[model samples]
Target: MIRGVGSYLPEKVLTNAELAKLVDTSDEWIQQRVGIKERHIAAEGEFTSDLAVAAARKAMAAAGVTADDIDLIIVATTTPDYTFPSAATLVQMKLGMHHGMAFDLQAVCSGFVYAVATADSYLKNGLAKRALVIGAETFSRLLDWTDRGTCVLFGDGAGAVVMDMANDEELAAGRGLLSSALRSDGHHWEKLYVDGGPSTTGKTGFVRMQGAEVFRHAVGKITDVVYSALEQANYTVADLDWFVPHQANKRIIDGAGAKLGLPPEKVVTTVDLHANTSAASVPLALSVAVADGRIKPGDLVMIEAMGGGFTWGASLIRW
Candidate 1:
C-alpha cells in the first residue's frame, strides 16, 4: 500500500517569457504548443539527490515512519548526481538510512511507474516490507539552453512515495497498487534522446527530440497502456476517479484523456506550473492531487508517462 506521498520543486523559477530572451521563442508560442508557463530550475550545486531527500523526508513524515523503517530505496532518474554510487544510495545516505537495498532505475519519464512495479513485486514477494520510491531529476542540466525547443520544456524537481506490503484483504479492498503495464521500443530511441552520454561522448549530453514524432506516438501508446492496466485490474475508464499523467504537454494529456473518454475534471495536471520534470512528473502530480484533497482513500487512480527512449507505462492504483 502507498502510505504517503511528497514532492519538491527547486526555488528557482524560469518563465517562458524569460526563456524567450535566451532563444527565439515567446510565451505565446510555448503556451500554445506545450502549455507551460514556468518551470523550476535547480540552483548551482543542487543535485538530484538533494531534491530526493527533501521529498523523501516529507513522505516519511506523512507515512509516520522513519529512515530506519525503510527496507528498500529506489530512485528513478535520467539525471543522477554521478555516474556511480547511484542517486538512490545518495538519497539513502542523506536520509541517514544504512540498511536495505538501494538502486536507480532509468526509463526517462516512465521511470516512476517502472520503479513502482519493481517495488510492488518486492513487497508482494516479501523481499521488502517497506520501500521508498522516488523520481528525481535535474533535467535543466541536460538542456541546450540555446535550443528553445527542448530547454523550455524541462525543469528540476522530485517526488516520492512510501509504500509497504499490504495483505490480500487490503488488496481486495482496493487499497494499494492494482496493476501496471510497461513498454519500451528502442527503435524509436532517436525520436527523443540525449545527444551525448558517458559511454558515447564521455560527457553529459543535451536533450534532443523530434517533437512532432513524439506527439504522434504519445497519445496512442499512453492510451493503450492505460487500458491494459485498467483491464488487468478488471476496471474501465468509468471506474477511474482520477487520471494523473506525465505532465509533458497539455496537448498530449488532453489527447490521451479524450481517447480514453475521460472527462477534463478527471485528469490531474501540473505542467503549467512545473513544466515537465521528466521522471518526476507522475509522482509530483500525484502528490499535488493528494495534498489538495482531490484524491481520497478508496478512489481509483490511473498514472502514466511517456518519455525519451520511447519508454512508456501506466499503473492502476486504488488510493
Candidate 2:
C-alpha cells in the first residue's frame, strides 16, 4: 500500500513571459500549443538529489515513518548529479540513512510508474517491508535554451510516495496497487531524446524532440497502456475516480481523457503550472490532487505516462 505522497517544486517560477525573453516563442503561441503558462527551475546549485531528498522527507513524515522504517529507496531520474554514484545513493545520504539498499531507475517520463511497480514487487516478494519511490528531475539542465521546441516544455521538480506491504484485509478491501502495464519501442527513440550523453559525447546533452511526432503518438499509446492496466485490475473507465496522466501537454491529457470517456473534472492537470517535469509529472499531479482534497482514500485512480524511448505504462491504484 502507498502510505503517503508528497512533492516539491523550486521557489523560482519561470513564466511564459519569461520564457519568451529567452527564446523566439511568445506567451500566446506557447499556451495555444502546449498549455503551459509557467514552470519551476531549480536554483543555481540545487541538484536532482536535493529535490528528491526534500520530497522524500515530506512523504516520510506523511507516512509517519522514519529512515529506520524504510528498507528500500528507488529514485527515478534522467539527470543525476554525477555519472558514477546514483542519485538514490545521494538521496539516502542526505536522509542520514545507511542501512537500506538504494538505486535509480531511468525510463524518462514513464519512470514513476515503473518505480512504483518495482517497489511493490520487492515488498510483495518479502525483500522489503517499506519503500520510498521518488521521481526527481532537474530537467532544466538538459533543455536547449536557444531551441523553442524543447526548452519551453520542461522544468525541474520532484514527487515521492511511501509504500509498504499491505495486509490481507486491505487487499480484500481493494486497497493498494492493483495492476500495471508497461511497454516500450526503441525504434521511436529518435523522435524524442537528448542529443548527447556521457558515453556518446563525453559531456551532458541538451533536449531534442520532434514535437509533432510525439503529439501524434501520445494519445493512442497512453490510452492503450491505461486500458490494459484497468483490464488487468478488473476495472473499467466508469469505475475510475481520477485520471492523472503525465503533465507534458494539456492537449495530450485532454485527448487521453476524452478517448477513455472520463469527464474533464476527473482528470488532474498541472501542465499549465509546472510544465513537464519528466519523471516527476505524474506524481506531481497526483500530489496536487491529493493536497487539494480532490483525491480521497478508497478512490480508484489511474496514473500513466509516455516519454522518450517511446516508453509508456500505467498503474491502477485503489487509494
Candidate 3:
C-alpha cells in the first residue's frame, strides 16, 4: 500500500514564449504540436539528487514516517548525478539512513511504474518492510537546445511515494497495488533514445527522437499494457476512478485514454505545466491529483507510462 505521495518541480520556469527567442518556435506552435505551455527548469547547481531528496522528504512527512522507518530506497531515473554512486544512495545518505539498501532502476519514463511494481514485489516477499520509491529526472541536461523537437518537450522534477505492507483489513478492502504489466521492445529503442552513454561516446548525448514513429507505436503499446493490468486486477475502464498516464505528449495520452474508453474528466493532465519529466511523469501526476484531493481513498487508480527503450507498463492500484 502507498501511504503517501509527493512531488517537486524546480523554481525556474521556461515558457513557450521564452523558448521562441532560442528557437524558431512560438507559443501557438508548441501548444498545437505537443500541448505544452511551460516547463520547470533546474538552476545551475540543482541536481537530480537534490530534486529527489526534496520530493522524498515531502513523501516521508506525508506518510508520517522518518528515515528510520524506511528499509529500502529505489530511485527510477535516467539522468542520475553519476554512473557509480546511484541517485538512490545519494538520497539515502541525505535522509540520514545507514541500515537500508538503496539502488536505481532505469526504464526511462516507465521507471516509476517499474519501481512501484518492483517495490511491491519486495514487500510481498518480506524482503523489505517499507520502501521509498521515486522517479526523478533532469532531462533538460539531455536535450539538444538547438533541436526544438526535443528541447521544448522536457523539464526537471521529481515525485515519490512511501509504500508499506497493508494490514489485513486494508488487504481485504483491496487498498493497495492490485496488478501491473510491463513490456519492452528493444527493436524500437532507437525511435526514442539518447545517443550517448558511458560505454559508448563517453558523453551524455542529446535526445534524438523519431516523433512520428513513436506516436505510431505509443498508443498501441500503451493500451496493451493498460488492458493487461486492468484485466489481471479484474477491472475494466469503467472501474477506474482515475487514469494517470505518462505526461509525454497530449496526443499520445489522449490516444491511449480514448482507446481504453476513458472519459476526459477521469484523466489527469499536468504536461502543460511540467512538460515531459520522463521517469518522473507518472508519480508527478499522481502527487498532483492527490494533493488536489482528486484521488481519494477507495478509488481505483491506474498509472501507466511508455519510455525510451520502447519500454511501457501500467499498474492498477487501490487507493
Candidate 4:
C-alpha cells in the first residue's frame, strides 16, 4: 500500500503569547476558540523547498528507498521559494534526484489531497513505480501580521507520502488508494485569496480572508467531500478507521465530525499545535497520526480539505 509518510516543521516555535505582542488577540481567545497553543515559523533563510526536502528524506528513509527509487516528485504549496524553477524541482535537486518528473501543485490548503490523488493516479496508471508527494509552505511569507484574525491561524511546515504502483485489481481488493473525489468553484474565489501575484501585481502579496465566511463553507464542503469519497469507494462514514481532515480550525473539525456522526476519537487533529499550515496541514496531520500509531496498516482512512481558490477534495485510502 502507498503509505510511507513523513513530516517536518521549522525550528522556531511561536506561542500565542508571543503573537499577542504583535496583534490585538489574546492567548485565551486563540486557545479557547481554536485550540492552538503554538505554531512553527520558518527561519529567514528557510524556504518551502528546504522543508520539503527534509520530509522527503525522512519518508525515503522510512520506506527504505532512495531518490533514484522515485519516478515522480510532486510538491504542493502556495508559497514557493520562487515563482519559477518550481519548489518541486528545487526539492528534487536537494534530494539529488535527476531522473524523475517533478512539478508543483497549487490548491491552497487542499493541496496535499490534490497531490496525493495525482500521485495515486500515476501509480495506478503504471506511469511511476514510486512517487514522493510533498506539501510544504512558508506561510509567514504571506501574512498580514496586522490582521489578527488570519495572522494567528497559520504556520510553516512540510509533510510527505511516498507511493508505489499497484494493480487496480489489487487496489480494489485492498491495496492502496481506492478512490478520490475533488471539486472547485471559481465563484467563491474572492472569499479568500492573496492580493498580489506574478501576472497581477508583479509582486508577492499577503493573505486576506473573511474568517466567518470561510468558516461557513469549510464545515459544509469538508463534510460533503468526505462523504463523496466514501460513496466513490462504495463505503460509508461508519467504515472509516480514521478521519484525517485538514488541520485548519478546531471548530470546523468538530463540526464536520459531528455532522458525519463521527466520534471525536476518530478525528485526527493537530491544529492546536500546528495552526493551519495551509497546504501542508493534512499531510502534516497524517504524518503525526501515522507516527504516533494512531493510524495503522489496513485502516480505512479518509482525507478532506478546503482552501483558497475555493479548492477542495477528498481521498479514501486503504492503508
Give the range of the ten consecutive residues with the poorest summed lDDT in model 1: 165-174
**Candidate 1 lDDT over residue span 1-319, tens digit each:** 8999999999999998999999999999999999999999999999999999999998999999999999999999999999998999999899887789999999999999999999999998999999999999999999999998899899999999999977778867868999999999999999999989888999998999999999999999999999999999899999999999999999999999999999999999999999999999999999999999999988999999998889999999998
Q: What is residue 139's positional error in candidate 1, in angstroms?
A: 0.3
Q: Candidate 2 overall Cα lDDT vs. reference?
A: 0.94
Estimate candidate 3's alpha-carbon lDDT, on a 0 to 1 scale: 0.95
Task: Residues 1-319, candidate 2: write the lDDT tens digits.
Answer: 8898999999999999988988999999999999999999999999999999999998999889998898899999999899969999999999999888999999999999999999999999999999999999999999889999899999999999999977889888989999999999999999999888878998798988999999999999999999999999889999999999999999999999999999999999999999999999988998999889999999999999999998999999999
Candidate 2 lDDT for residue 296: 94
Q: Cα deviation of 81 in candidate 2 (Å)?
A: 0.8
| Residue pairs of candidate 2 with colliding backbone atoms | 298-319
In candidate 1, stretches whose alpha carbon ends up further than 4 angstroms from where it belongs are none
What is candidate 4's TM-score against the reference? Answer: 0.97
Q: Candidate 1: which pairs clash?
A: none
What TM-score would every model get versus the actual structure?
0.99, 0.99, 0.99, 0.97
Reference-based TM-score, model 2: 0.99
lDDT on C-alpha atoms for all candidate structures: 0.95, 0.94, 0.95, 0.91
**Model 3 CA RMSD to the hidden true structure, in angstroms:** 0.6
Tens-digit lDDT track for model 4 on 1-319?
5648899999999999999999999899998778899999999899999999999888888888989899899999999999998999999888887797999999999999999999888877888888999999999899999999889999999999888865667556685788888999989988899999999999898899988889889888898888888988789999999999998889989999999999999999999999999989998998999999998878999989999989999999988
